[model samples]
Every structure is written in C-alpha cells, then in structure tokens.
Target chain A: AQSVTQLDSHVSVSEGTPVLLRCNYSSSYSPSLFWYVQHPNKGLQLLLKYTSAATLVKGINGFEAEFKKSETSFHLTKPSAHMSDAAEYFCVVIRSPGKLTFGTGTRLTIIP
Target chain B: EAGVAQSPRYKIIEKRQSVAFWCNPISGHATLYWYQQILGQGPKLLIQFQNNGVVDDSQLPKDRFSAERLKGVDSTLKIQPAKLEDSAVYLCASSSGLPGLATNEKLFFGSGTQLSVL
Candidate 1:
C-alpha cells in the first residue's frame, strides 16, 4: 500500500518570504512523487515530479521539491512567496503504473 | 495541444437522483482517470481506464457508480441514486501513456464538474 501525508492543512507566508509545504509518504515499492497546484475553480496543474532520477526537482513558477528516501519525505518549497502562489497543493504517490494516491492537500495563503 | 475537456461544470440534484458527467481527453492520450474530491480533502481515484478497457476500479462504488469510455477518446461517469456523501467535485484526467512507464508524463486535468446533492 502507498499513501502520502501532507503535514500542514494550511500555511500562510508573507510576500518575498520563503515558503515550504511538507509531505511524508509510505510506499512498499520505489515510489514516484508529484506536487500539483490548484487555484480556485481551476483544475490541478503539475508542479514537479520525482521518479528516482533527481532528488532535488525544480518545477514551474520557481517551485521545487526534494525527494528524501530515508526520511520518506518529499517537501515542496519556493525561494520567495508571491500573491499568485496562493492555491491548494497536493502531494501524490504512485507505486504502480497509472495508480496515484493523493494526500489531503495543503492550502497556501500569501500575505501582502 | 488542447487540455482535457469536461461538461456540466456544475450540477445540483436531490438525493437519490441520478447524474452523469462527461470527459474528452487530450489528443493521443491513452489513459483516463476519474477522481472524487470532497471539500478540504485531496482527490481520490474512483476509477481508471486504458483506452476503452478498464484498468482499475477497485475504489468505485460499483452499486451506484458506473463509467465507460466507449471509443477510448471520451468517457462518461454516471452516479445513480446518488447519496449526500457523493456531493463533491468530479475531476477527469488523462495521460499519454501508462503513467509510471515514463517519468516525464503527467496527468492533464479538466476544470471538473461540481456536483451538489441536496
């Protein structure tokens, strides 16, 4: 069985400050991890993915995530926060082909 | 490259009523998925299809929830005799190949149909 746990339900950060959203996973096999972002009334868009290739994965909009096998963690981060970054973030784990188990999402709020 | 397309962006029905949602994946996408997302929660996979064949539907409520992708290009999910708990956003996603086979392939999602059961 494979599952992901997002550590925070909601996170608030000031503009120009750094941002971090934590996630942990449990997978029996080598797992593929992904971070997706969803704005209000919009569908999910892929931010980044890790497939046993690179531990530090960079994504669109200056967002990135690091895959830590030892820690069972894949935490998403950004160098600085922007107003447009406010959205719901989901951490997903896929152990088998075409099967994805998603975490309970983290809501990010950007403060001006 | 057009994104996945879904219909009935919003729907409202009474409990025990039936509803259906449709999806059209991006061109050349061979895999499709249906997910249920409740308020404040992540999207949960209800079913998956490869072309016109069913791949995984272990989590779908078979008694009342059914889906089909007749031509493998478009799909439909139907919920008969809906329950109050079924009120949520239904998202349709598609990928070019079997997901894990390629590391760079990602699921493209539609805006989703929001179902509200009264």
Candidate 2:
C-alpha cells in the first residue's frame, strides 16, 4: 500500500518569506504523488502532481514541488508566502485507482 | 464548467440520528468519490463509484454508512445511528474515470457538507 507522511503539523511564515512543506511517501513501485490545498470552508484544490514525468513540478498560485525518488519525498515550495495561502495542505499517494491515501495534513499560516 | 455541487452546507444532528448528504458532480464525470475529513486530519476515502457501480468501499463502515451514485451523476451518503466520531466534513469529488494509475486525472471537489454530531 502506498502512503504519505507530512513532516509538520503546522508551519508559520511571514509574508514575503519562502514556504516549504515537507512530505515523504512509501510505495513499493514507482508511484504517483500529489499535493492538495484546502482553504477555510473551501474544497480541496490540486496544487501539483508528479506522474513519473519531470522531477520538478510547478503548480498554481506560484507553488511548486520537487519529486526526489532517492529521498522518497515530494516537498511543496513557494518563493514567497501570501496571506491567502494560509490553509491545510495534504500530501497524497494513490494506493490504487480509487484509493487515495492521504497524510494527516499540515496547516500553513502566513503571518502578516 | 460548473464545479461539484453539494447541498445543505451545514448539518447538525444528535448522536444516533440519521443524516444524509447530496452531491452533484461535474457533468460528464464518470468516477465519483466520497471522503470523510475529521478535524485536523486529511480527507479519507469512504466510498468510490464508477458510473453507478461500486468500485471501492473497503474503508466505509457498512454498519452505519451507506452511499449511492445512481445514474452515474449524482450521489448521496447516508449515515444511520451516527456516532460522535462520525462528525466531519464530507467531501465529494469526481474525475473523468481515467485509468487508476493516471494520478493526474484531476479530481473536482465540492465545498463539502460539515456534519456536527452532538
């Protein structure tokens, strides 16, 4: 079974500061990974995905993530933090077609 | 295109009571999923349907939870004799029904129904 672990329960950063949310995955085979963000009272939106393509993947809202097989990590990053970026982020791995195993989640708070 | 639509944005019920949530996925989507998101946790897949057929329900508590996706479009999740542990935001998502390995199928999610079991 494929699973993911989010390193931080919560992360705080000042506006204009860089943001990093760490995630590590375990899968027997080369698997697909994803990062999804959920804002307050909103739906979860896809941030980025690594589908065995490029090692570096870019997503919406200036967010990006790097897939490192050697490290078994797909950490999300951004050059700067915005107040609106405050949300709960989830690192996900697909155990199968309909099964999407998710990490506990990491809450990101931007300090203005 | 319109996003996934869910009804009764907020629901509150006493323990052991029955509750149901409705969801309308994006048009033309063939795969629908229901997820339970407990506070401070990521969404957990409860059930998945591929065009009105059950694809996965291993994590679903069949004793109290039930879900259906009739006609391969809309879906409803029902919980009878609910427990306090069942309190969570129920999210409905849909995809194009691509192969399972296609992780980038791009799931469209609903705003979710927040269920509070008192």
Candidate 3:
C-alpha cells in the first residue's frame, strides 16, 4: 500500500531560519501526496498537494514541496520560518480508492 | 464559505458507555468522512459517506461503532460501549469531489470533537 514516512517526529527551528520537514514515500507507482497543517484547537488545513503536475508545487502560506521521484521523497520547505508556523504537520498519500494514509506527523517548533 | 462543522467540542464518558458525535459538512459537498486522531499520532479514517451511502467503513470497528448520513448532509458517528482506547479526537471532513479517487481534490475539515473515554 502507498504510504508516507515523516522522517522527523519533531523539528525545531530558530525564527527567521530555513525550515525543512523531511518525508519519504513508499509506493510502486507515482502517487498523489499532500501536506496538511493543524494548529491548536483548529482544523487540519491543506498546505499543498502533488498530483503528477510540476515536480515543484507551491502552496499557501509561502510553503512548497518538491516531488523527487528519484529519491521517493516530497519534503516541505520554507525559506524563512515564522512563529506562526509552529504546529503539527501531517504527510498524506492516497493509497486506494478512498484511502488516504497519513504519516505519524511532525510537530514543528519555532524558537524565539 | 463555511467549513465542516462538528458539535460538542469535548466529551468525557466512562468506558462501556455510549457516545455519539455529530457533523455537518459544507453545503453542496457530496462526500463526508470521519477520522480519529490519537494523541501523538496522525488521524485514521473511521467511515466515509457519499450522498447518504456508505463508501467505506473498512477501518471502523463495527462491533461497537456505527455511523450514518441520513439526509446526505449531516452525519453522526456512534460508539457503544466505548473503550479506554477510544480516547481521541474525532474529526469531520467533506469534499466537493471524490477524495482519494481524485488526485487534486481537497477536503474542508472541522475543528473536531475531543472524546475522553475513561
């Protein structure tokens, strides 16, 4: 089954520094992948998605993910981290007809 | 536009009790889903409904779990004889198009209902 693995369970970055959340995927074929973020007491919001379009996908809030098939990875990156970026982020991959498998999640912390 | 709506932001019940969670998807959405997120883990799908019909419930524990979308707009998930392990956040989501079947489709989510089963 298609699934994604978030290499880091928690990532901490100083404010204004670059942010990188690593994610590796396992699938026999090219798959649809997504990045979702959840804030405290809020819904999970879509960050971005890769649907076999351009290898590089830009999403809301200055976030982007590059689909690297050769490396089987779709890592989320931001040029500069902000305090508001602290939250739990999930990596999702569509497996079956209605199945979207989610990784354990990566909690991002922004240090002042 | 209004996002998915879920009721009772929090619930606390003893094990073996029965509890139900309600959800109202965005107007005009055809697909609704229920997911359970345990602390420190990602959300897991419980059931899915497409226009008042069951699309998927493979992961739902049918023994004590049940869900329904009667009018195809609002949904309810019930857990009878809740277990200690049932403590988690119940999330409701809706999409205008088929979710996993369509690669580009997106889902609107609710804040979720936190259930604490003692």
Worst 10 contiguous positions by lDDT, candidate 3 chain A: A93-102
Residue-wise C-alpha lDDT for candidate 1, range B1-118, written one tens digit per residue: 8999999999999999999999999999999999999999999999999999998999999999999999989999999999999999999999988734864468899999999999
DockQ, candidate no. 1: 0.61
- TM-score for each prediction? 0.96, 0.97, 0.97
Q: After superposition, how far is residue A71 of candidate 1 from its true place, in Å?
A: 1.6
* Clash pairs for candidate 3: none
Show the lowest summed lDDT stretch of 10 residues, model 3 chain B.
B96-105
**Model 3 agreement with the true structure over B44-76: per-residue lDDT tens digits:** 999989889998999999999999999999999
Query: How accurate locally, in lDDT, is each candidate?
Result: 0.93, 0.92, 0.93
Per-model fnat list = 0.61, 0.70, 0.64
lDDT of 3 by residue, A7-72 (tens): 999999999999999999999999989999999999999999999979999999999999999999
Better of 1 and 2 by DockQ: 2
The lowest-lDDT stretch of 10 consecutive residues in candidate 1 chain B is B97-106
What digit string (tens of lDDT, one per residue) describes model 2 on residues A1-112?
7889999999999999999999999999988898999998889999988898899999999999999999999999999999999999999997777568889999999999
